[model samples]
Target: MAVLGAVGGLLAALGLLAFGLYCCYVRYIHAKYDHIPGAPRESFIFGHLPILWRMLRKQEFMHDLFLQWAEKYGPVVRLNAFHRVSLMIVSPEGVKEFLMSPQYSKDPLVYGRVFSIFGERFVGNGLVTVCNHEHWHRQRKIMDPAFNRNYLIGLMETFNEKAEELMTKLEEKADGKTEFSMLTMMSRVTMDIIAKVAFGLELNALSDDQMPLPRAVTVALEGVTKTRIPFIRYMPWKQKLIKEVKESVRLLRRVGKECLDQRREDIRNGKEVTLDILTQILKGDALEETRDDENILDNFVTFFVAGHETTANQLSFTVMALGQHPEILERLQAEVDDVLGAKRDIDYEDLGKLTYLSQVLKESLRLYPPVLGTVRWLEKEHVINGVRIPGNTMLVLSTYIMGRMERYFKAPLTFNPDRFSKDAPKPYYCYFPFSLGPRSCIGQVFAQMEAKVVMAKLLQRFEFQLVPGQSFKLVDAGTIRPLDGVMCKLKPRSCAGSCQA
Candidate 1:
C-alpha cells in the first residue's frame, strides 16, 4: 500500500511539471508577438485586460494610450488581452499587404462577436460584419448600383427636404444663449434622412425625440459595444444592459421585417418602384446569386445604423472643431457663403464646388473618424517593417493612431483643413476615414453627400458658439462620437434666407 501511494505521487508531480513547461512555452517562447516591443501587461493572466476595462468604464481617453505605445515601441507594437496575442500594425506597408488583398479576410472571430449581441442577431450577416470573402463580394456587387452617382443625385431632393427640416428645428434653438446638444439634433435629422432615403419609412426622428426606432437603434448599438468586453455576458451586474440590448435588437429586426414585407407587397401590386435603397435591396434579392431573407434584414439594420450614426458623429465633430477655431469657422462659413449663397437646395454640382467645406469635413474625419480601426485575420506569415509576423494572428490597423502620428502628418494634433486642399498631396495609406481598397465603405458617396447638404445648409443659416465646460474628449461606443454631445449655442448667419452672407 505504501509503495502504491508513492508511485501515484510521483506521476502527479510529473503532470504538474509538464503543464508548467507548456505554459512557459506558450507565454515566453511560442507566443507569436513575443519579439515585438509593447507595454508590459498589467497581469500575466489578464494581460492589460483590467487596464482596458477600467479605462472604458471610467470613460477616459484611451486612443492616445495606443499612440503612446506606438511612439515608444514603434508602429508594429504588440498588445495582449488575456492569453491572446494581437499585433497593432500602423505601418503603411503592413496595411497595404494585409488590407489590400482578399487573401486576408476580416477576422471572423473578431467581427463575429458583433453578429449576435446579448443573444440577439444585431448586425447578423451584413456587408460590414460578414467574413466570407465570396459572400461579401456578391453582396457588394449587388449593392453598388444603389450608391451610383445618378441614383445618389436623385437623393438630393430627399436630402434637401430633410436637411431643411433640421435647419428649421435648429433655427428655433439658435437663441445664442440656450445651450443644446448639436449631436442629438444631427442624429435626429440623419436618422430621418436615412429612413426616408433608404427604406421610405418615416422614422420621424428629427421632429420626435421619443421615436421608437431611434431609441431602439441607440439601445441596440449599446448592446453591440458592451458585449465586446471579455466575460461581460457572464456578469450578474450586466443583466440590465444585456436585456435592454436584446429588446432593442428585437425592435430593429421586427421593424425591418415589416418594412421588407411592405416593399415586397408593393412590388407584387405592380406599384412604381422608387429610386431608393429598398429598390436596390429588392434587386439584390432578384439576383440568383444572393437571396436570403435574414441577409436582407441584416442589411436593413446595417443601413440604418451605419447610414446615420457615423455621419451624425462626423457633423458633430466638425461643429465642435469649427466652434473652437473661429478663424477656421469664419473661413469655412465664407466658402459656404461663396458657393451656396444661402441656396436651400444644395445640388450635387454645388457639393463639389464647396471645396473648403470638403476640406473641413476631411480634416474632421482625420482627427475623429467614426471608425478608429479594423481587424484582419491573417492565415499566412508576413513581414512588416523588417519584422516577421506569424501566421494565424489577429492584425489591428488603427487610423486613430496613424492620423495622430507626427510621421504621417505635420502638427498631427492641429485642426488644419488646408492639408486636404487640392494642391496638397493626398495622404496615401495613412488617411482612411472611410477606409480604402475593395472593402471600403460602399456608402462613402451617399454619406459625403448627406454630410455636405446638412453642413452647407447649417453654415448658410447659423453661426454656432460652443458652450463652456464641455469636454472635447471622444468616446468609443461601437462608433466614435463626441463625449460631450458637442454642446453649442447658435445665432443666425447674415444669409439666413437670402444669397448674401
Candidate 2:
C-alpha cells in the first residue's frame, strides 16, 4: 500500500510538471506574437479560440471577424487559434510580395484540410491544394491549353447553350409571383456547363432538380468549410454530417473515375478527343512515369467545384446586388440591351462591349468573393506594413476584407459599379477577386466570359426583384455565398427590341 501511494504521488508530481510545461509553452507562443496587434485574448491557453468558436456557432463568416480586427488593428492583424499564429495582411505591398512570389507556398495545414474530407481522399494534390511549386507548375502547364484564348472561345457555344437553358427555366417562373432561389438555378446551370464542357459528360443539372451530383458538390464543399472547425470530425454531433461529407466525396471521386476511365479508353481506341479539361488532366498524367489516378481525380474535382461554385456564387450575388440597387440594375439592363439586342447567341466580341456589365461583376466579386481569401506559408521572416512577422507563419491574404476597407475604397460598403468604370483610377493590388500572380486562377477569363453571357442574357430576358424578408447575410460554405440563396421573383422583360428566343 505504501509503494502504491508513492507511485501515485510521483504520478501527481509528473502531472503537475506537464501542466506547468504546457502553460509555459502557451505563454511562449503568445509572447512571440504579442508585438503584433490583435484582439484581446479571451483565454491564455486557447488564444482567441473561444471567440472563434462563438463566431462559428453563430454561423458567422470567419472573415467578418478578421474584418473587425482589420478595422481595429489596421492592415496587418495577428490571429491566434491555439498554437497556430496567422497574419492577416492586406497591405498592397504585402499582397503583391506574398501572393506574386511562388516562393511562398500554400499553407499545408489549410490546404491539407481539403485533401481528405473526414479521412476520405478528396482534392488530393490538385493544383489548388498542392503546395509543391514544381508539381503544381507541371500540372498547371498541362492544364493551360484547356484555358487558352482559342479554347475558351470554343467554349462560348457551350456557355450560350447552358445559359439559354437557364433562361427557359426562369421564364416558366417569370410570372412575377413565383418565388425561387436564383442561386439554385445559377448553381445548376454552371454545374451543367462544367460537366458538359470539361468532361463531355451530360449532368443536365439545370433541367434535373433531382440530380444527385449538385447535392453531392454542395455537401462536399460544406465539408471543406466544416474542416476549418477544429476537431469537427471527432465531434459526436457532427458525425452525421461528417459521414455525409465522406459519402459525397466518395460519390464525386467515383463519378470522376468513371469519366476518366471512359476518356482513357477513347484515347486508346484512337478516338478524336477535343482539348477539354479532362483531356488536359489525362495528358498531364500521361507525361508522368506512372499515372496517379487520384491526382487526376483531384484536378477533376477541383475544376468541377472551382469552375462552377465560384461563378455560380458570383452570378447569384451579382443578381442580389442588382436587385437591391434598381438604378444599377436598370443601367446594366440598358447596357445589355444595347450590346445584345434581339440576339439569341452572344458572340465572344460582344462580351467586351458590355463594359458596365463587367463593372457590375467586378463590384459583385469585391463584395461577395466566393472563395473569400487564400493562405500562404511564409518560411522566412518578413516585414509587412511596418509589422515584423516572424518566419514559419501562415499569411492570410483576404480579398473580401480588403475590398470592403475604407482605406482601399471610398464608401466601401456602398454598391457602386462605377468604382470600376474605365475612367476611374484602377485599384492597385486592392481588388483581386480572381486573385493575382502566377498561381492566380487559370480560368479567370473562362469564368468571366461565362458570367457575362449568363448575366447579360438574364438582364435581357427577365427583370428580377429580391424576395421580401430574406437575409442578405453571407455564408462561408467552403466558398462565400448568400445565406438565403438570393431568393427572387422574376418577370419576363417586354421592352422594345428584346430578344424573344
Estimate the TM-score of every prediction: 0.94, 0.97
Model 2 TM-score, all chains together: 0.97
Q: What tens digits encode model 2's per-residue C-alpha lDDT throughout 1-501?
A: 999999999999999999999888877877888999999888777877898788889987777778878989977888887677888888899999998888999999889889998899989999899999999999999999999999999999999999999989998999999999999999999999999999999888888889999999999999887887877867899999999999999999999999999999999999999999999999988899997898899999999989999999999999999999999988888888887887989999999999999999999999889988788998988888888999999998999999999999999999999999999989988888888888999999999999999998899888889999997999888889899999999988887236432
Candidate 2 clashes between residue pairs 3 or more apart in a chain or in different chains: none
Clash-forming residue pairs, model 1 = none
**lDDT for 152 (candidate 1):** 90
Off by over 4 Å in 2: 1-9, 496-501
Best by lDDT: 2
Using TM-score as the measure, the top candidate is 2
Residue 236 CA displacement from its true place in model 1, Å: 2.8
